[model samples]
Target: MQFFKQIKSILAVSLVLLFMAAPAIAGQPKYVFYFIGDGLGAAQRQFSEFFLQDQLKNPNSQLVMDTFEVAGINTTYCADTLITDSAAAATALASGVKTNKGVIGKDVNGNNVKTLVEEARDHGMKTGLITTTRLTHATPAAFASHNISRNNENEIADDFLNSGVDFFAGGGIRHFIPASMKIENADALGKTIKSKRKDEKDLVKGFEGKGYSTFIGMKGAKAFKSTDFSKQDKVFAAFTYTHMPYEVERMNQYKNVPSIADMTRAGIDVLAQGDKGFFLMIEGGRIDHAAHANDPSGVIWDTIAFDDAIKTAYEFFQNHKDQTLIVVVGDHETGGMGLGMDSMGYKLNMAALNDVHVSVEDTLNDGAGQYKGDKAAYLSYLSKNFGLSNLSDAEAASLNKAMVSADAGETLGYYKLNPAALTAAHILSTRANINWTTTIHTATMIPMSATGAYAGRFGGYKDNTQIAKAMAQTLGFTL
Candidate 1:
């Protein structure tokens, strides 16, 4: 009887150990959603959270990304520079290798490096790349194409034809068409598609020949949903001629263009149809653009829009918790943005930003030219559009100085911002107590957060290259 009792105890211990090890034995995740917020840093994200809380009048409001279990800080320096550009930063995040600035999916010696997308495809998984910028841009191109320079959009566009990626979305239609071809009547935005390619080869037709069902502009995005892709799973979609409009601009005018969240949902629905699983990369590309312009409202709104896209992935994760992994990270920090300014004396009035209804880009494009020379008219325009009504004598003088320069068609600052637009944007940002150190990329650390299968692998402080390394390990492959 004693011997039998000991045998039963041993059996119970064995069963407990087996159950605990079950998840490890389950192999790689079936679905992976990789989200990259271009130029998103700690302050950029915090400002968005603060903006939302103020907008909702709830102090306890939090971003969905802040609620993730696995969170860490990621260094963003490149191999050759302290401050990394989008191309080199993206290559490190996608290939687990750091290259010099301006290089994409290639080493310092110009040798091609295999990216995570290539590994996913090798493992019999479907891949998709979606971004608010052109698909041929640095972030997306780093994953699927190899080139010596990120500026070679024509070469990057050609790479998509044979990348074996099942789905493609966002802008860059110009690079695909021939220089002499005019494609306006067929474009959904009713804008002419002029080619940037030096060759006469029409790449859109090339994509079509490779068994891809291509869609163009807002109309194309809507048609992408209704069409049946069960027979042909490959798809290519371009929603604009260049980068997608900033969130503020889109909300006020381009209502037909799809949001980043819209594209994320669409990419998931189409890519998830396969049985072997899928890898989808979604980039909020214009946060970098807005930050480079020192437009606080533009950055806040676009980051909010990016988080909405993450919510879409989080919802999908909820249903497939055991088989899905969602990772959210920023390629690098832009603008050196901060929450407090010296004049604010430790106070940040996020609520003040609510008075401003438009972005700096729109203000310059639509209104600045109309009220340039007249002091009263320009001040009135500032009050109506940028929410600056009662300016002190010095503030008014500063704005007047900018107006004179703008009227003479001058572009000022390091990023060559319109003088009037830059002045108005700075004043608006000051009202909210936000400060920017520079209108360029900063070597600051960005945030990385994840959830679901093997999400714990990404926790703790790490370099940007480790991101791809961790993903490869989670997927049971080598980067």
Candidate 2:
């Protein structure tokens, strides 16, 4: 009788504690800012680590949120063969359900579903979307809209009018403008047999009409335009409707085009100020683009820049401590990028990662001018930038042959040319080293990490839907 009384007392106390905790757990403050580095894989992460290491005072220094946790999730085929595309991956991450390769925000049967972002809004949180790609790009649209095909971005962009989120950014101004305002959708037109959205609705005006504060270009943003961002709660920026210029082009052309860091900083600044807190999705969309072209230098540079953005968010959390939860991850891998091959016996010189670069566009247009062949001008430029004064005549001749697309293998172009690839190919055949099967995404698991509040749920092996479902539950919302 005495022992039975003890067991009963313990059970009664445990049940009371459980009942007492339910409301407190349900009412806990919630925040989630997810960053997707498209096509970023282990190689991209390592490359960024080393790229920043070389530039940092202490080589061991990692980006701010680097220590969260490391987990790998399998990236498999959608409706296609072995690999996946950004459209498919985005749909998987956003909707917690996988779709076919070219589809967005829907399933194989074309059923629309609840995205985490929509769930957050339904639960009354401010929402924001930011990316280095065009605003209407596949990744961003996954959370905002659904379509039978990814090519229907214009229609998807229209869907943002009703998304009711607080923030949006990136490029592709042309996509949001109708034919009356644009040579509209030339890029989309060139991709299709019949392009009907060539002249469509203006997504910018659509957002504005929906009560979003919208603008084009970083400078044109009324919020970014003034140093005082008190107006940001009432304003959101959309600088370009299409993809932002590549980092190289941005550095060379616009001089003031904000780095990924700047954009992230501004987005967080505005989003966090609200009483309801917010959910923001920022992307390094071009790291994938550069990787697809197999341009190691371009990809490396973008990876470093992406780190800059991560650092911005990392610092914010550090300041706010437990108030914010930041998760950084990648959607898929691309270009089969291998930093250093075992066959080559040369680890990429941690120092020289970005030393060699030329774009495929640059190599294709080599010796040939935009008008006619300005052979002298092109030769002078190469000599000034990349002349090898100490090569043996025979080897130099072979190299020159390769440079002009006359080599025994793949065409030598900007994406194709880089010192590391050259060295690797010299030791191993081009078929072995830097062997890009296609300019498409590959089936390599992506890494995800997180810090602050319920972060214990992250890391280790998991599936795509698991991430969304876990995050949704953590933030006190359901997907």
Candidate 3:
């Protein structure tokens, strides 16, 4: 008995000395905010970065990276193909495993899959998904819901409800309303039984079933695209559908809609409420859309909006400091967006055109929807909006000829294959590298940038799936 007591005293003294000499364990970074800009790749980021710096100030300069800019190369391929869509890229980012294009997180075998956000929830972290696109938009949905097909948005909505995420905001009112309230089998929607989003009563009721309490814009007031959020015991997913309106038209259509900055601030406000940390995703979705439309003004403004949102989030992260990790990247580059017309085989003057509208497909293949005075309208719109003050006489005459000729079938726009205006635009695009392909997604890798707790997870060659895995590991969730 005396020997045992002596040994116990010695062990206790040793343990105390060891603990006294040990360094403190750093606090676990309890939060992660993963942002994805769909359809935006390296070109898009380069575009936004330059335009914002050239015109607007650095919106993301709050982070340490803004002072240094830690960038990485990331390949964006889907499970089944080299090219990918939002659904596939998003799934790759949501789940660390690549899946087929058009499929959410499930394999071809149709098995359900867990996403990082889902894992975050399983680990007791509150998860919130926010986007300028629909709440069920592919990227955010990739985190919260998994359906065999991305097209089954209604089922996706149900999945979101079941996921028990604490907060969600965006459009897609069409998905939540019940089929009864919808225009069933309308003439415009021939052969398709369009799902009505009018089932607000039941839809909100469904979230309430999951211990959720809030679903906004039920009565269709103004597309609840506001920044103010409510805090309570239940899950909240709100925001009217109506495509959320384009950036240029949003202020005109919905006076109450929050700016991207406002949305960012509001999301962090609500998502940060959980004591167990939170997983929040906020998307600058329209940057990709505007690029796809080949609209420079739209792209520029939306990029500004996206940047402002990033700035807001970075500020929030700053307040929390090392307790949060932020990962911002594009799923893929859309429109093969590029910069510079130096290689286009001509020194065309874009100073003569503004809203260039010629289609390459039509001009090259006698396709439908010809230019229809594209040169004239584009020049006019450009002069009005773009403020191109350097219209040379020769350039003006050439544009005038193209407009008239296009009316008579000259096919001078990009779609026509002549690519004069595109070439001209390329000149402007390359000055800061803001060129773009036609209005479509291109097969290009996107950009990835990071900061905070796991900022080092980026800064090298990577793939889209690595983004998901990085987020998980950085947050200590480790899939």
* Best candidate according to lDDT: 1
lDDT string for model 2 (1-479, tens) is: 99999999999999999987663345444557788989888777776676677768577977654667644454545655457778888887887787888888898888887787898787777788888887778889898888888887778767877777777777666666666653332231121112235775766677667666666654453335354544566444655434665565455444455667777777777777777777888888998877766655556667777777877877877776666778777888987777666544654555433333343222323212111234344334433332322345654555454444432345433454433234323422232233444455778877778877666666678777677767777776656
lDDT of 1 by residue, 1-479 (tens): 99999999999999999887663336569999999999999999999999999999999998898889999999999989999999999999999999999999999899999999999898788899999899999999999999999999999998988899988988878888888977664444456667788989887788888887888765785686566655547788887777777888777666777789887887787788888899999999999988887888889999999999999999999999999999999999999998897888888898777877667764553443344567687788778776788897877888889888878888876767878777877888888899888889999999999999989999899999999999988887677
Query: Scored by CA lDDT, what does every candidate get?
Result: 0.86, 0.65, 0.63
Candidate ranking (lDDT, best to worst)? 1, 2, 3
> Distance from true position, residue 87, model 1, in Å?
0.2
lDDT of 3 by residue, 1-479 (tens): 99999999999999999977642224546777777877766656655555555443554533222342567878998878787888888888887878888888776677767788888888787778778777777887788778877877777887877777887766665676566654433211111223455344456567766776454443322323432544544345454543444565454334456566666665677767787878888887777765655555456556667767777777878788778777788888777775566544444223223332332221212222233456655665545444433566765665566556555655433334333343334334543334565656667777778877757866688988887777766665554
Q: Where does model 1 exceed 4 Å of error?
A: 1-25, 183-190, 222-232, 362-378
Better candidate by lDDT, 2 or 3: 2
Q: Which stretches of candidate 3 lie over 4 Å from their true place?
A: 1-26, 56-69, 182-201, 208-238, 251-253, 343-434
C-alpha RMSD of candidate 2: 6.7
Arrange candidates by TM-score, highest first: which order? 1, 2, 3
Q: TM-score of the candidate numbered 1?
A: 0.90
- Superposed by TM-score, candidate 1 places the C-alpha of residue 337 at a distance from the truth, in angstroms, of 0.4
**Model 3, global lDDT:** 0.63
